[model samples]
Each structure stands twice: as structure tokens, then as C-alpha cells.
Target: MAGLDFLNGELEELKRQGKYRLPSVWESGSGAWMDIGGRRVLQMASNNYLGLTDHPRLKRAAVEATEKYGVGAGSVRTISGTLDIHEQLELELARFKDTEAALVFQSGFTTNQGVFGTLLQEGDVVISDELNHASIIDGIRLTKAARRIYKHKDMDSLEQALRESSGYRTRFVVTDGVFSMDGDIAPLPQIVELAERYDAVVCVDDAHASGVLGRFGKGSTDHFGLHGRVHIQIGTLSKAVGVVGGYAAGSQALKEYLIHKARPFLFSTSQTPAVAAACLEAIRVLQDSPELGERLHASASSFRTRLQADGFDTGVSETPIMPIVIGDSARTMRFSARLLELGVFAPGIVYPTVGEGKGRVRFIVTAMHSDEDLAFARDALLQAGREFGLV
Candidate 1:
């Protein structure tokens, strides 16, 4: 306790800098609208893209699995944790992605860590996009492989990075399918072309794109029609799936290798039966009801267009994740708080989450939001923006 006294000074500094904060207490499920601090607000800040977190089918599947398999997986997959449901989920994922096979991980972040750590070695070189998710950066950092970062979505920069890394035994090109902050999609077609030319293995982190892109939400690779051309496809079961887990879809050999070598998969406990069942049902629901994604895209387009027309900077976003850039960190926080006051629950993303002077309030458009819900959110945002002199 004596040695940790310096934490008090750090906390004070964070507060002074307008960075210290606590998560809001959500009093309801992560639906299009939720109750927070006794106030019912339109929830536009979560990753529940399809709003399947509270879907009846998912809930039913979870309950059934809980009854059948109890609560936990009890241990890691490599030991006694692997269950029939887990295998079924992986099979379903592989079929959904059109991959030879697939492997599941504890979370999206862990999937990145596992794949990067297991695949890349001392002589390998990983070429990444500059704005890839932090999980990707951290995963690449954990490996002994050399890392090269290209400018975000710049194909020429990616090619140069590829050329420079040609000498390495294995050239791995990694990128996020949908960049979380700016919401811009990666130039996967160009990336694939370059990777082909350089013989680099293409690894796409489709955490945000999985349930938001492609036919029936197969993901970015399928959206671009790259399919089997891309070697590795990493996805999350949490975001659009409305559950908790991550996965890697690719060749059978890759799945075999990661199962044996990926430290995260080998060490972490398998997903709970309920979670796996719910995720499996989520995929089925997506396939059964493609209208959910269509509705989401349409709503997002309208909302984003409205914001842009209102003179708000919704940076390079071509997807549902919209970032209303508010240059100053404190101002962004103030804007977010004001939105809460106006019956919206969007959160502010600042500093380390984004670049300096790039603070913003991120809004995630979901399929569950009705026209009335979005209209309410739009009005609240504009009111808050006008007060801050943003519009």
C-alpha cells in the first residue's frame, strides 16, 4: 500500500487532464434503448449491431444450453473443456465463412493474440495497417516477428511495406476489416492483390465487419468476394453475434496449428455452453433474417447523412460505427455528458483510444433501433452539438 501511493498522484493527474472516469451504470440489457442511472436513454454506444443480445431465439438457446450443459466449460479447450456444442459452433462458423475449418477463442482480442503469437515467429514479418485495432497492435507486439505499419487504407504504403518485408521467411499482412474509430473499411481487394504479389499471408481482423458486411454477414472478405483467396479470417462472436467469444476461420491446417500452439487457446478456458449456443443461434438468425443487416445499413446511412448535412464531421465512416469528431478531449467528454442529459447514452472516445486532437463521441447504429428511436437520438445529438457550437 505504501509503494502504491503514487497511484493517487496519477489519478489526480488524470482528473485534471479530464481523462479519469467511470463507466455508467446500465440498468437494462444492451438493446437499442437502455436505462442508465434511472434515466432511459437511446443506446447508441454499444457493439450490439444486430441487437441480438436480447433476441428471443438467442435467449432461448442460451437457456437450453445452460440446462443441458450446466454453466461453465471448466477448463481450457486442449484439456477437458472442449464440448460437442463448441465443435458444432466452429463447424457452423466455418460453414458461415466458407472456410475449410475454424477455431474459437475466449474473445476477439484473445483471437488476435492467439493467431499472431502462434503464426508469426522470429524470422517472420507482419505488415499491418496503421489504424488496426489495439488488439492487433498488441498481438503483433507479443510475437518475435518484425512489424511494419502502413498508412491506414493506403494500398501504396501497404505494397511498400510488403516489398520491404519480402526478405522475411513469412510475410504476414494483417488489417482490421472495419476500423473501429473512423469506421472506414480496409481496402481488402488491394491488400489481397499485394499480398498475392508478395506471397504474404493475408489475415483480416473482421471483428466489426463480421455481422455488418457481406451476404448474410459472412464478413468483409465475402463482401469483397475474396473468399478462399484470403488465408486467415479472424472474427468476434460478441459484436453482431450478441454473445461472448472470438474465432479464426481458415484452412484445417491453421486450425490444427493454433489449437496446438496458440497460447491463448491452449491456456484459456473454453467458452461457456450458454455463450456458444447463443452465438450459434445468432449466426442462424443472421442467415434466417438478412433483413436485420439491411435495415441496419439503411438506418446508418440515413443517420450518417443527416449528421454530415448538419455540419458534423463523421470521419471517413462507411459503416454503422460513426464517430462525430470533436477536436478537444474535454469538449468531447462534455458533449457526451450533454447527450446523456438530453436522453442519449453515447460515450466519448478520447486520447489514447484515438490520436491527439481526435477526440470523438462514437455512435454505433444497430438493427433494433426504430425510426423513432434514431430520430430521437439525432435530435438529442444536434441539440448537444448546437450547444457546444459544433453545428
Candidate 2:
């Protein structure tokens, strides 16, 4: 058959299996409210946890940097692409993470890909949380190392994998700082203890945790007081920092080695000067203002309490990333549609993003949302649930 025909056939199969996903288009900047195809809606699907995406400080910094450095880095870091701004951003990230060193990548996904593929070799083993983000899984797949998956947040299962991998030349336990799907925190302290006992390196993907958890938002390691125990700390600037790109924090030697060996870092152009400068400003904003974090947590608490009180089945979510479980994919989709009609913009999350029979409408709260905004969302969601016969 023709190539287009084959592609269409695969897409049809995916649709028939209830696994095809089409994203909605948004025309405005990310905030508590957004414009979706000309309709204004209360956005509860963004990872802009701290709501800094359109902050004046970040915009000014980005604009100034663009004027000074132009649009792109023009080359990869290993070649002549390591701009002074890139170095500054790396140093700032290292200081913020309290790590010996840091390395910037084109994105959070590539950071995982580069770090994991560079560190693990044929005889090595990677024990990862089953629900880890796709980037980590893909990164492991790119490596020659053996991969073992443990039940999500199950320390005993992780220990078993670690114990079974004793013969491997190297063992690394990888997990998300805060599981994106369920919004539950990883048992990092237990994982750290196990890593020590098993002589394994512990790495955490803090994509969702960096700008929302810990004191001054230092991420899961600081949240659990693990500090120097975590061998690798990966995070993104696109989420709460409300910019673009990603970084990995670790010992100076590890970063130096990745600089020379990691293909993505060596081959990809560095992040634009505007993005790097904006990220730096965002970090400064987070550090100087504790009110943003407090407001975000308060909004999350309020929403969670109201949802639970109204009898919505919110799973074990302790963070701003909450999910209203609806089991059936079609029903979850319908629920999200109803929510959209009610002027809320949370999207349905179905299989592949989650496991089978675990479809839900994910709600993300932001610090920029006022009490009225949250109250409006709660009312809208309750109405949608009742209309859909969910509650």
C-alpha cells in the first residue's frame, strides 16, 4: 500500500483502540485564563504552576536578551555555541539546585535522553519507576543498558529490582520527583536509603516538582532533605519557571563528562539567550517571593477540599496537579467536554498518559488564580459532574 495509506491505517487502529489523542489549540499566553480558538476559558491544564509565563519581569528580561544576543545560539555548545548567557544560566541553576555543577540542554526531554544514554553502558542496569515520564523511558531505550521497572512508588519493588541487579556493573534507580499523572510524590527518602544499601545511583526527574515543591522550590531532593544524596537532578524551565529548556544538576565531574559525551548537548544548539535570561529571572522571582508558592498551595488545598466535599474521586494527589478519575475513556472525554462548555479548560487524560481503566480529567491550579477564579472552577466542575451523572 501507499505510505500515506499505511499511516492512515495505523491512525485508524489507534482511534479504534480509544488511544488516539488530538490536542486543542490555544491562541493566547498561558495563564489562569486562556483563549482557545476564540473562546475564553479558565485554564486548568497548564503546568505554569507558579503562573510566571507572562510575568512582566520575565518578558522584559527575554526582550532585552533577544535584543542583545539575537534569536538563536547558532551552533551546538561543544562547537562554538556555548554563549556567555548559557554559562551564566548553568551556574545559576547549579546554585539554585545546591549542586556542585549543572548542564543545560535544549529541553527537559532531551536532558533525560542525553543524561541516561551517556551514563549507562551495555553492562549497566536502570531500575525505573513504572509510571516515569516517556522521556526517561525513551532515554533508557536508547542506551545499551538493561532496564527494569518497579511498581510506581513501591519501595519494596524497587528494592527487589536493585537486589536482582547485583551482578550488573552499574545500577541506577530513576523516578519522577512528583508523578505527573497521579500527582503523588515519590518516596525519595526511602529510595535514597535503598540506593545507598544497593550501591546504586539515585536520579530524580523533577519536571513537575522544581517550581512548586520544597523550600524556595529547590525540588524533591530538598523536599525530602536528600540534598547531595541524589546523583542526578533533572528539571525543566518551561513549566513553573514559565520559560523553555531543561537542565541536569549533579557533581562537577558528572556534568563535565556529560558535556563531552552527551550527544544532545554536544550536537544541539543551546537555548536562546532570551529563554535563558527569562529562566534566570524566574528563579530570582521564585526565591525572592514566598507568597507565590504559598498562594499556589492554598489554591490547590481549596480546590482539593471542595472537590472531595462534592464527592469527586480525586486520586492520591498531594500537589496542584490533581485528577478527577472517571475510569472509562469516553466518559472522561465527555466530562472534559462538559467542563469546556462550562468555561473550564481541563483536558481528559486517557491511556498511554495513564494506564488502562484509569482515565481522568487532570486539573492544574496556578498561583495567579484568585479565590474567585478557583470558586468559579469548583462550581463549574461540580455542575459538569452532575450534568454528566458523574457525581
Candidate 3:
């Protein structure tokens, strides 16, 4: 058979296994309600947790920056792409994170790939949570380091892994501040204690935690009050902040080392001036407006409470990323399709993004969603659950 034929066969097998993914197209801006495939739908599937994506301040910043700097940065950051706006964004991020310095990447995924692959070497060890984001997993794979996986949120298992890798030159313990799939928080306090005891550098990917946790959404470190203990904090401006880019907050020396040695930062073009300017404005908006965060939390809590009361299994959720468990992948898809038909846009998450037999319909609440919107969504979901026998 031809190689092309073999690739087609593999794709067919994935479809048969209920694992093939085809994302829907959106034709509108990020908001509480969105236009999906030309239809208006209540959006419960976006990562815009704080609803800053469409904020007036961010839009204005982007517009002004575009007019002043044009569109693209035109070259790699190391050469001529490093604009004044990029430096300003970095400064704003460092201040927001309360770190000495920060380095911005084109995207969050590349940030992880750059940081892990560049920093770790052949005799080093990476002790990672089993449920870490795919970027981290791929980053670890790219490195020559020995990788160890500890059970999710199992501090004892992490400690054991650390103890077993004592002879390595460097040990890195990495975890997500918020487990994206399960919508659960990391046991950061315990993890930090373990890292300290084992002399391990702690790294947290706060992709979902930033702009949704702690006082004014300072992220997991601030939420747990372990700010200085976390060696590296990875955050995305695209999610809660409503812009496009990722940043790593750390000491000045670490930021300098990444800027010099990290392949992604060295090779990739810096973020567009518009994106960086928008991100800076986003940070300011987040700091100035506490109401947005409160509304988001209140909506999330209401949704969680209603779902639990309605007999839905929202697995260990402590944040806006709520997962309504539906064990069968096909059933989950049907539930999602039914939701779409009912003018709601919550999507079914299936393997291998999640584990087998753990398929769920993930609901992401935003500050823009009103009480009426939440009720509409809740009623739609409950109806879908009944229709699909998921309840």
C-alpha cells in the first residue's frame, strides 16, 4: 500500500475508535454569546474565563498599536523583531506576576517547548504530573532528560519520584496550576513543600489559573500564597487576558538565560505589536476591574451548584472549567450536538484529550454570561442529559 493510503487507514481507525477530532469554525469575536457556523449560540466552550477578549480597552490598544507599528514584527526577536511594545508587555507581565523579569513567547505551547527543551539536559530529571498539558509532555520528550511521571495530585507519588532521582544533576517538578480537563486545582502547597524538601525547581503552567484564581486573578502561586517558592510560572495572554502570547515569570537571571538560549524565543518572530499592546492593556484592565472576576466566579459557582443539584458529575471542579462527566464518547458527542441544537455551544471532550471512558462535556463560564444565560444553559444541558440518558 502507498504511504498516503496507510495514513488514511490510520485516520479511519481513529474515527472508528471515536477519537477523531474536527473543530467547528467560529465567525465572531470571543464573548459570552458567539456565532458558530452562522448560528448564534451561547458560548460555554471558550477559554475566555474573564471575558477580556472583547474588552474595549484591549480593542482600543490593539487598534492604536496597529496604526502606529503596522501589523507584524517582520523578523525573529533576536534580530529586528524585538519592538518597544514587546518590551513594554514584558515589563507589564513581570510586574503583574510580581517577578523580577519575564520572557514572552509567540504562544504558550512554544513557551513550554522552549523552556523545557532548552533548560533540561541528558542527566537531568523532570518529575511531572501525569495530567500535565501536552506541551509539557512534548517538551520533556524533546529533552535528553530522564522523565518521571507521578500520579495526578498525588504528592506521595511525586515525593517518591523525587527521592528515586536524587543522583540527577537537576530535578524539575512540573504541574498545571489548574488541571484543564478536570477543572481541578493542583495541591500547590504540598507540591511546593515537596519541591523544597527534595531541592527541585518548581514550574507551574498557569494557563487556566491566571485571570481566574486568587485575589484579582494573580494565579495559583498567589492563590496558595507561595509566590516566591515557585521557580517558574508560565502564563498565557491569549486566554483570560484576551490577547495572543505566553510569558514565563521568573528571576531576572532565568529570564535572561531563556532569552539567550531558548530556541523558540531565539528563532520565532516576536508577537505582533498589536497583540503585545493589547496584552498590556489587558493586565491593566484585570487589575482595575475586580467586578469581572467576581461575576465570573459567581457564574461558575452557580453553574456548578445547579449541575450538581441536577445529578451531573462535575468531577472535582474548583474553577470555571467545569466538566459534566459522560462515560461514553458517542453519548458525549450526542449531548454536545443536542446542546448546539438548543442554541448552546458547549463541546464534548473525548479521548485522548481525556482518558478513555472519562468523556465529558466541558462548560467554561464567563463574566459576560448573565444569570438568565446560565439558566438557559443549565436547562438545555439537563434536557440533553435526559434525552441522551446521561443523567
Candidate 4:
């Protein structure tokens, strides 16, 4: 309590800079629209890419699971929490991912920690993209492995990192399949080719890519047809799957290895059986109907095209997650507030989430958004931009 006052000063400074994160209260399920601050608004800020959060099938699956099993697993997975439904979910996940095995974690962040902290050790090397997610960065930090970071999507730099790590016992090239803030994709096939030449393992965190890329939303590996070549494919059940949890799909040996060694998996309580059941049903729905993903990408593409044509700098986005770069953080925040006032829920992204002078208001397009919704969002963005002089 004696030193707590300093934190207030820091927070005040953030507010003065308009870099403070003031999250809105959401009173409704995420979909094409959401209730925020007692007002229903068009939501362009969610990761519910396929709009499965309110799907009757997913809801029914979750309800049935909660009825059959209690609300929680009640213990860590390594102890008394490995429910039968958990195994079933893992099996289905493996099948869906076309992998030999799968192990679910409490979250996407924890999944990264589980893999990196367990598989890497002293004398190992981790080659990461400079723009990889913070969870990946923290996971690498947890290991004693030598770390080398390459420029974003720069294969030459990646090769340089690999070349420098040749003496290590094991080398890993880690990247996000779809970069969340920028919405660009890592060149997985190229990364794989480099990893092969350098005898490195490849780990792609497909958190954003899942259910948004590939024929049936199998993600970057399947999108590029590099299934058997990649070593670790990490994903989340929350975003596109419209549930909650994370999983790493790989060889059977890999799953067994993580089961024993991944601290996050061993220490955290298992995902509730209901969540597992819902996620399982989500995969089944994706496999049964490919239109969901197709619609997602189509909607995103249309939005991005319209935004660019209407004079917004989309900043190299190729996926559903797109950013409207408004360099000054304060101005970006103002733009976002103006957007919210005008009935769009697109929020501002600021440093250090993004580079200095590159703060933006990121927009995520989902299948839930129709053509009318897209047009409405775009017009709001344009009006807000003009109001704030961001255009």
C-alpha cells in the first residue's frame, strides 16, 4: 500500500496520452451486433469470424454437455479432471486438424506456453517472427533456448536466424499463421522450406487463421497444402470455433510429451466438458458445411475492398482482421469514440500493441455481418475519419 500511489500516476499519464484502454461493457452475445453501454451497435471488433457463438447447434451441444457433466472439470487435467468428453474432443480435434493427436489447454496463450516451455530447453534455439503474438514471445522467454527474431514476413531474415542457430540441439521457427493486428499471414511454406534446410521444427500458431483460412478452415498448413511437413500447429477454440479453449495438434508422441511436460496443461484445470463438447460440435459443423468459412473470407474481402476504395489505408491486410491506421494514438482513440458514437464498435489499437506512430483502429469482419452491415460499418468509419481528419 505504501508504494501503490505510483501506479495511479502511471495510469493518469496513460489517460493524458489517450492510451488508456477503457473497455466497453457488453451485455449481449457476440454476433453481427452487440449491446454495449446500453446501446445495440454493429460489432466489427470481435474474432467470431464464422459467427458460431450463437448458433443453435453449438448452444445445444454446450447445454447437453452441462446437463450430462457438471459445469467444471473440478481439477487439473493431470489429476482428476480428464473427463471422457475431453478425450473425445481431443480425438475429434486431431481428426479435424489431420494430425496424429491433439491436446487442449485452458487458452490460446497457455497453449503457446505449454508447447514452448516444454519442448525447448538449454542449448535449444527458437527463431521467431518479430511480429508474433505476445504469448509466443512470453513462451519463448520461459525457455532457456537461444532466441533469434526475424523481421516480419522476411524470409531472408528468417534464414539468417536459422543460419545463426545451427549449433543448437533443437531449433524452432515460430510464427502466427495470421498476424492479428496486421491481418497479414506468415509465409508458412517458405518457413517450412527454411526449417527443413536448417533441420528446424516449425510451429504455427493459427489462432486467427483457424476457421478463416483453407478449404474447410484447417488453417495455414492446409491452406498451403503443407500438412505433414509442419511440426506443431497451435489453435484456439474461442475465436472462429465460437467456444473457449486452446489446442496443439501434432504427432501422437508430441501430445504424449506435452501431457507430461507442458506445465500449463498439467497445472490448469481442464476445459469444462461443456466447452469441449461445443467445440467438438463446431468442428463437425465446419466439416459438414464449408460455406461458413467461405462466407467469412468473402465478407472480409468485400469490406477491405470497400474501405480501401473509400480512402482508408487498410495496411497490408489479407484476412478478416484489418486495421485503419491512424498514426497518432490520441487521434485514433478519438476516431474510435466517434465511430462508437455513430453506432460501430470498432476500437483503437495503440502502442505498444502496435509500433509507435502506427496506432490504428482494427476492424474484424465476420460471417455474421451482411452486405448491409458492411456498408453501414464502412460509412460510419468514413464519417468518423472525416470528423477526426484521419482521412
Task: Report the C-alpha lDDT of model 4 over 1-391, residue by residue, as the tens digit.
Answer: 9679899999999999999986688999888888977899999999998888888999999999999998998999988999999999999989888999999999999999999999999999999999999999999999898999999999999998888888999999999999999999989889999999989999999999998888789889999999899999999998999998899999999999999999998888899988989999999998988988888888888888888888899999999999999999998888888998999988999999999889999999998889999999988988887877766
Q: Which residue pairs in model 1 clash with each other?
A: none
Model 3 Cα lDDT, one tens digit per residue, 112-204: 999998999999999999999999999888999999999999988999999999999999999999999989999999999999998999999
**Top-lDDT structure, candidate number:** 1
RMSD of each: 0.8, 1.2, 1.2, 0.9
lDDT of model 3, residue 102: 93
lDDT of 1 by residue, 1-391 (tens): 8999999999998788777789788888888878877878889989999989999999999999999999998988988999999999999999999999999999999999999988999999999988999999999999999989999888888888887877899999999999999999998998999999989999999999999999999999999999879999999998999999999999999999999999999988899999999999999999999999999999999999999999999989999999999988888988998998999888889989999899999999999889999999889988988999999
**TM-score versus the correct structure, for each prediction:** 0.99, 0.97, 0.98, 0.98
lDDT of each: 0.93, 0.91, 0.91, 0.92
What residue runs in model 3 are displaced by over 4 Å at the alpha carbon? none
Off by over 4 Å in 1: none
lDDT of 3 at 147: 91
List the candidate numbers ranked by TM-score, top first.
1, 4, 3, 2
List where candidate 4 sits over 4 angstroms from the true fold: none
Q: Please give the range of 10 consecutive residues that has the lowest summed lDDT in model 3.
A: 14-23
Q: Which whole-number lDDT from 0 to 100 does residue 372 have in model 2? A: 92
Clash count, predicted structure 3: 0
- What's the CA RMSD of model 2 in angstroms? 1.2
For model 2, how does the per-residue alpha-carbon lDDT over 1-391 read when each residue is reduced to its tens digit?
A: 5657789988998777666778888899788888987999999989998888888999999999999999987888887778898888889999999999999898999999999999999999999999999999999999999999999889889989998999999999999999998899999999999999999999999999998899889899999888889999999998998998999999999999999899998888888889989998998998998899999999898889889999998999999999999998877887888899999998999987888899999999889889899899999988988887778
